[model samples]
Target chain A: MALENVALEHVPSGYGVYVGFFRDVTNADFLHQQLLSRNRDFEYAFIDASSVISRLHLLSAVYSALNTLLVGALRTPNVHSEIVTSFNTNNNIADAYRRWGITPGKTKDLIVVKIISPTAEGQNGFSATSARTPEAIWAHLTEHVMGKPVPVTDSEIAQATDWPKVRKYYRLNGVPALEKVADKAEHQRKMEQLAIMGMALRGL
Target chain B: MAVPHQQQHQFPLPQILTHPSSSPALLITQGAEGRLYKTTHLFPDRPCALKYRPSKPYRHPILDARLTKARIAAEAKVLERCWREGVPVPAVYAMDAANGWLMMEWIEGVPVRQAINEYLGSGESQEGQEEAEELGDLMRRIGRVVGALHKTGVVHGDLTTSNMMLRRQEGEQKGVLGGEVVLIDFGLAMQSMSDEDRAVDLYVLERAFASTHPRAEKLFGMILEEYGKSFKKATSVLTKLEDVRMRGRKRSMLG
Candidate 1:
């Protein structure tokens, strides 16, 4: 019921981006299994919420993946998987999966991102009407994923963040630009900037 | 045979910009290598500048792709390096090097060139004690930013007042020269540790500063004075700048 229909700037209107967050997820294994089995119904980016920094950070990855899909330059099997890969600061896809992807037990909090674009629906051989509405997607997620649904907001995302893991993943430890910042909010802002920059300059 | 004048002058939007958005992407400027668009990044509230490099019709497809990709990647890399070192520059938002487009944070305020001209043109007399001090401060900020850039082992190949933006400070009064000096246009930037490269960068800025702000050319020394104090190796770079100034931007014209 907490699934939010997110609207990204510059993204085509036909592309529907729906996001949902869950805390203390109990059925991560089942969701992980569905992803591994390539279940058509489970075509969502199941991200470990702990590794994410904030709403902006999550949206940036989604934007990058969506852009890749638009340009027909997807490196992963699908745009869902590409979202996870876009979080990486390098080209190693497996590393990205291990770091940001949902694990069976380690992923306590979960962020599910469903991108319903024209290409995805057409390629999946589903008519526009039959290709999963936001309500249908929410119904399916609530019935399957066992967790406490939370609004996908910055405050909620901040609670689930593991700073140590994020620092290691984004290489934000002891950065001179960050070290010099004395204010807490400014520090976090700079960290987010650096992390986004890391993702933008990936493979370069 | 008669296409409307407005339609005739309008260039085709890049493939990315063809997508629907909250607002229409406005073409800000067109350069020889690329075009800049004032657009949004991820959210409509976050405005960003999107630089798009269109493919050249003259070059072979393969070579053109390679050159475009390499240049975009190089510029992004240099921008990232400068950002990490705390150099006042626009943070890159997103990029598709292969697609020849880079999105960066939109800096607010006028170009340094425009700011200087406005200050100088305010009064008929050349010398105003208060205005001179304000201009001196702006020059120091520019020098410090350039020095910090060099310390990070990057050389901005093109250094001009037009390439630098005067970002307004938070809660600061509008139309004042006091603000952060953010360098932009890294299309020709590169990573280098050589004194010659650093000196050449300074020399280019000096030449550009003189031409752009001829009335305030005497204030150029304030920039160098701040540059010398910005880093440890700045003195040596300044010494090398004299040699560069004598022979001009070219060492020996082999090209």
Candidate 2:
């Protein structure tokens, strides 16, 4: 079946999942409200494949040289456009969810997978799934699709493998590690080194 | 004793009036030029805005003086023209171009950008979708003001939300007829009959709207529609505006 033809049907009756299709996320108010009327605490998600790839590419480059090498190997001349196409085709959805640690089944009561168009014009597309435990899916993505080690770093392991510290950290930071700064001094040091190295390599 | 109107004279650093008796009670120091003080005149029993354009260290003293004088004269001329043309701009009360200081009627109201944002409900969580139409209407009015300014050969160089003030009308003045929309800060304003200058002014405004307001395209479209209807000469200007929008404000070397 064509990917665009993939409709959200797995969601249970009486509950409606409204997907906002927009070129930009700023114009998703009407769609947000439409879903809100059906469910008071409707889940809000922004899945921009291009933005996701851009962020992942940036993070992959920053995190580890191995991941950067892997990404570089996988990347083509039109890597962004290729990833966008794959994402639109629903081929990369599971991998994307695993990368972000977003468990679809965990929030079956709410909406999921709100894909936004990768253009200047605001267009939104949405999808839903059945209420099944996403552990197997997550395991498959981590073990197979990623082809990289599960709980890639000690921090990820600490957050996913160890929940207490994660909860504590969230309580302290008011958001997850992904949102807030983990170590500002470390980040700053790395940034300075990168700058100096960049300047040196350019013979500046 | 009436304050003496100083002629084209030597540039001097403006003295900061701190005393409430001598200056206005509330002095807000905000703006690119320098410190902007909102002060009142006891003799006239009216409030006024005092903009003190600080001396630039980069330029030579002679060049700085000449530029300052030219800018002050240009601003005063534009404001006078706007006033005569029934444009809602601040009335220029006093100006010492030599010292890079301009005193004008202090407008008491929130900025139109702030008002529109507040009306639209800006925060971590959105709240005011119902007032979007009203906000749209106000945005169009601002566009009309810009269009009118362009028609009269004046360009508000820095056409941003912060520069536009929306004064609330007093009791029994609750409607549109009661309240006033006054354009302020003519420090960077210039007189230009060229469409390129006007297009750049509009481009600046468009960029400002995009940065300041969420979903500003629809709002800006409404503004453009109202602005287009304000003046007959605006058609050619609007067409040039499209070209400016396409190429952007910066001139491309390729062209």
Regions of model 1 farther than 4 Å from truth: A120-131, B1-9, B124-127
Task: Give the per-residue lDDT digits (tens) of candidate 1, residues A98-186.
Answer: 89998987999999998887664548322344337888988888988899999999999999999999999998887878877889999
lDDT of 2 at B37: 66
Q: Candidate 1 on B29-130: residue-level lDDT in tens?
A: 999999999888877789999999999999999999999999998989998888888898899999999999999999998899988888777762355676
Candidate 1 clashing pairs, residues 3+ apart or interchain: none
- What TM-score does structure 2 among the candidates reach? 0.48
The sequence of per-residue lDDT tens digits that candidate 2 reaches over residues A1-204 is: 001111221111222222221221232344334333533122234233222222222222222211112234333122222222222212343443333222322211111222222222221111123111234323322232211222222232222222332233112223221233368754333332222222111111
Predictions' DockQ, in order: 0.78, 0.00
Best by lDDT: 1
Report the C-alpha lDDT of model 2 over B1-255, residue by residue, as the tens digit.
Answer: 564223322344255332213332344754566667666432234577777777789989999888876777677667766754657787664444665766666788888777766655545224466355556667677878888888888988888888888887566444331246788888788888787888788788888888887665567877788888888877677889889989888877893
lDDT of each: 0.89, 0.48
The 10 consecutive residues of candidate 2 chain A with the worst lDDT sum are A1-10
Docking class of 1: medium
Give interface RMSD, every candidate, in order: 1.0, 30.6
How high is the TM-score of chain A in each model? 0.95, 0.18
